[model samples]
Target: MSKHNDQIAELLTDDSFVRWINGDANTLEQRKWNRWLEEDPANIAVVRQAKKLNELLWFEEEQPNTQKELKRLESALIEERTLPSEGINRGGMGMALWTKVAAAIVLLITVVGVIRYAHWGPKEPEATEQPIMATTQTGYGEVKRVTFFDGSKIILNANSKLTYPKTHQGGDMQVELQGEAYFNIAHKSGQEQRLFSVLTAEGKVAVLGTKFNVNTHSEGTEVVLEEGKVKVQKTNPKDRANKPYIMSPGELAMLFSNKSNIKIQNVDSELYTSWKNFELKFKNTPLHRIADRIEEIYGVEVEFSNKSLREIEFSGSAPNKNFEVLLEGLRTLLKIPVTYEGNTIIFGS
Candidate 1:
């Protein structure tokens, strides 16, 4: 027999196969089924096991109502089909017969239900539930600017994900962040003012009306304040639970993951926020550090083949030029030969 026919037979007998049958099958599914049947001699054996389990569940004489029987059949089919292939013996007729019986029972039960309930009136539909909030993903080298319902704005950096409620909750305005984002929150009065919180890997940065930039990635969590103040608290603070740092403007907080240590530094807010205007400003930054920042901003990899070149420090501002121009400028300044292979920039002697 053809492998496809055998698989169909095996599937018919397997009890757990019901799940696959009832589940939605799209274009790829049909193609997969065709492919499976076309390949492998053991496909037929697997189908038989499914058929047998299905029959046992559906063919019971004392089976409940149509809906109940359908549910039972589905459950049994799933269980039987999921069984290990090693446990199935293709050489035996007992397995084949059992699968055939199960298949027959399920089919008969389904047929009877269809005949009896064909004229049954449809029931009123239940009240619709609120839809779940969908996650927004930013691809590599892509950035997105989104404005919230409350007039707050978020600028998502490359390769980031931002998930928020579909409908704003009155008690608290909260957003989950992964990667980097710059927020400009709108001022609100009364209880609404006290409810603004931005959740990140480090902790929750709570504010009423403030502007801040948060970077949460594999490297670490960084929060830079531009306007107003924000209270940075570790979501799971152990000892200093009561004391949360109130970050003011012109201050930057760095929370290192390797050690649960926090470092506060004085920063030039305008230079930090230069990316907002599509500019990369480097002030006495190491060549390696500059490469790291460029990789993060543009979602590209930079490799310095020469160890000596990696230690060199660069101090210059580069317009948000195209990748080629940026590379050429860096090469000219560092006096090193650089080549671009796909997305990776290689610096060599």
Candidate 2:
């Protein structure tokens, strides 16, 4: 038998879970499902895969656009299957793992067929099945915790919006993100390991399972790895010739939208990821970079009177505090001048 066969089978056949997957769960069933997720964290990844298959099944059955999606998947799979296996001498992503998973399922679509394969998960719901989707948006001063049926949770930062399907596709997961979020991705093992991926305008980050942070804006996309590894692929047409960068724990990947080159550096993960804990930390970080982050988090603007202010590096941690108090702490800690004008903060004389 294949790895994870028993656990996967149980989840796919669970009566209450099946109702929830097909979006037919009653109030009591929904409550029970949530309780099941809480009872054992390890069950999260298994449940997530089941959800993905459910969404794919529903989409193929009800959506008018299924043909278009299937065609794309077929092309991708054919292309992906023909590519020679390149040895990984380095750390980053090769061919996208998501594509491979999609291809594996596509073969099933052709053999067992789409409709028959769709029924592999559970008994079809009598009610019509539609594609599952949900979105969460947070205010500038707010942070929200989004829990996926897979048990993976996302801590969405202020002024951010995240859109995700109700379930993953083919047991591989993908998400579209705008703004910033820290992901505590649930890990899948056995056959499904190494299938979690994030897509941004700048590029894509793929991993089997890991803790990481992703930030995207007009400037570019930044990925910081706290634990585990990730493959960061550059998506620019101009940089198509560039090699994908693989990052290990304690490393950072910066992909600029305007340039084809990617920059990699070592960083203190706490400096980049501690925001979720209401802690701001720095290690010889420049004031201007600090100002930029303050703007992102507080929804305010910051200006330095002199260009030199942008290059001053200091080391410290700022306790999670209100905007004004944080600026005051900076001023006192650095012995520098800081004044506020409405929502904007100006530094240096």
Candidate 3:
């Protein structure tokens, strides 16, 4: 099995993880698993896979007698397969181990088959049976472009991931995002237009074909509209009851992690969306803010030799396609000493 399959198999065999997936874990176990997820956001994807597998394995509460089901499943596997030469034992212990491994591999194969069918299956009414889900990701200092079947496009920023369906047909369309992206949503024709939405851990942004930028961070999420309009809502209960904030072009909507209020203000959309064009526009933007961008894009730590250098402002544009190019431009434009030590970038002599 592949590394991912190995992870899923390991997770499936763990009692705590199984309980967590079934939502039967105690409060302490729940808290522990929650913390594990919060520590590394990437774990969420793995957990999602595990949950899907668990669901398909008849691990739900509706299962008619889980013990009997397991016995039937194990007997069927045992009858159909033989153990390896080394693990073969008359005592039945090896059979048990082989059964578990085989079950996980079967589940993996089922998932792959579903994806394959989505790609190559007949294009009749069965097309909607398996909605093809696609994922686009960019590593540190890397960017990616994703275009939907409808010609709508998204320029995903560095250290970002977007999970969306391959097609935008069938009612409202939605995509889940982690990190930042610039969206150029295409308007659907006809009198009834389908609503498009972007979902983040912070909240959701609903629109009807618009140009916008969404940035999700540890603190919260920010939506900057460049063209058309968008509606921003907060998922937190304290703010959920309130109506979503309707936004216009050149407007910014913010939802803070700790705050229950959704704040709206007018802003220059270019400053936020400029990265989509491989450029960073600074209008009296301070060095600290620049450092923040460098850290975010390059996945590095930034420091200032003198704290006051952080407050120094610059009004210019710099190429962001390459970290080295941006760093060189900053050095010449700021007329300051910029050096790198290990993975950390330092400004000031």
Candidate 4:
């Protein structure tokens, strides 16, 4: 095997390469992989097979634990490369280390194909570790609390769903969110620390330990950090030019749905975060947005009959009060006629 071939052989065991194969590599790492493939045409096939093997092992969420089989396949390939080769036809190709790797991948894929299609047809193979799936959801006018095994707590707001796996192979503690939720992540210090991430349609919020609120809607995604620090990324794949926002305490990151702009601003974090405590606090917050929050929190439809009222701003606080008291309070504050109908509140006339 040539030096380059040895490098290629060593690449299979490289963790970064494995991460790239699993779609976890950052941009620089992805570029490095691309550059490596461009340097040598043969590197393309090498990486392709490596990725195929990785995808196969991670194909299904409840896939059989095939880690041992992968290691055995790699080991067997190296051992077989030492066989007698005086007149061994390498299929008009050199007997390089890369060739052995490609051959081994093919052999392993064929054997696994037989086992998967024949033995495990229609039924998923049993595995030592089961797929971890847990979820918490809240309907309109409702709130829910979920505690993870790692002692982290999530206070989900109305019209929200949170789903998470137990933990990832690389010590990743991740969750997927739609709508709104407040996270009070437990600090997993020292060796117990895990990489925690909150993924949404807009992007993701990553932190080791922090208290944050994530609100993802059709309009945009908002991440407000109350304690500690977090990185909120605008990770829509179609828009790659947006940079990720690193938010400190009392900071908010907003990624608008229509644009690739990520804006960070210092804010009264409590106003955006106090919902979990059944408090609605505002600091000259726009009336339209506040109405949206009111509807979300109480399942009551709030609408400004006129466009002018929508642009009005309000500054006050309201506990988890019923609809009439809240409507009368707002009417007194803004001096507007508040009409309460069945399940709907209108602030016009």
Best by lDDT: 3
Model 2 residue 15 lDDT score: 83
Worst 10 residues of 2 by lDDT: 111-120
Inter-residue clash pairs, candidate 2: 44-150, 52-168, 92-246, 194-208
**Mind giving the per-residue lDDT tens digits that candidate 1 earns over 1-349?**
4766665665665444544454545667656755775697665555455555555566546755899767877875774455332211211223344333433332333222111111112322431233244344443444567787778888876546666757654435567677777889887897565456777666677788889988886656788999998877665467453357889898988765554556789887765666655566777677798878777755568998978877777766665534555666777766678777766778775
Candidate 1 lDDT score relative to the true structure: 0.63
After superposition, the stretches of candidate 1 with alpha carbons farther than 4 Å from their true spots are 1-132, 169-171, 328-337
Superposed Cα deviation of residue 266, candidate 2 (Å): 1.6
Q: What lDDT would candidate 2 get against the real structure? A: 0.71
Off by over 4 Å in 4: 1-130, 166-170, 237-240, 321-325, 328-335
| Tens-digit lDDT track of model 2 for 1-36 | 355667777777788788887789999998988898
Alpha-carbon TM-score of each model against the true structure: 0.58, 0.59, 0.62, 0.58
Tens-place lDDT per residue, model 3, 1-349, is 3888889889899999899888899999999989999998878988999888887876445547889658866864773354232211212213344333433342332211112221222246754565666665554666678788777899888667677877557556778787899999998868546678897776788888999999988788999999998888876546445668889999989888777778889898999999888888888899999999877766668999999988989988888757777777888777899897776788988
Superposed Cα deviation of residue 77, candidate 3 (Å):
26
Ten residues in sequence with the least summed lDDT for candidate 1: 111-120
lDDT of 4 by residue, 206-279 (tens): 88898999998777889999999888877665666877778999988898878788888989999998877766
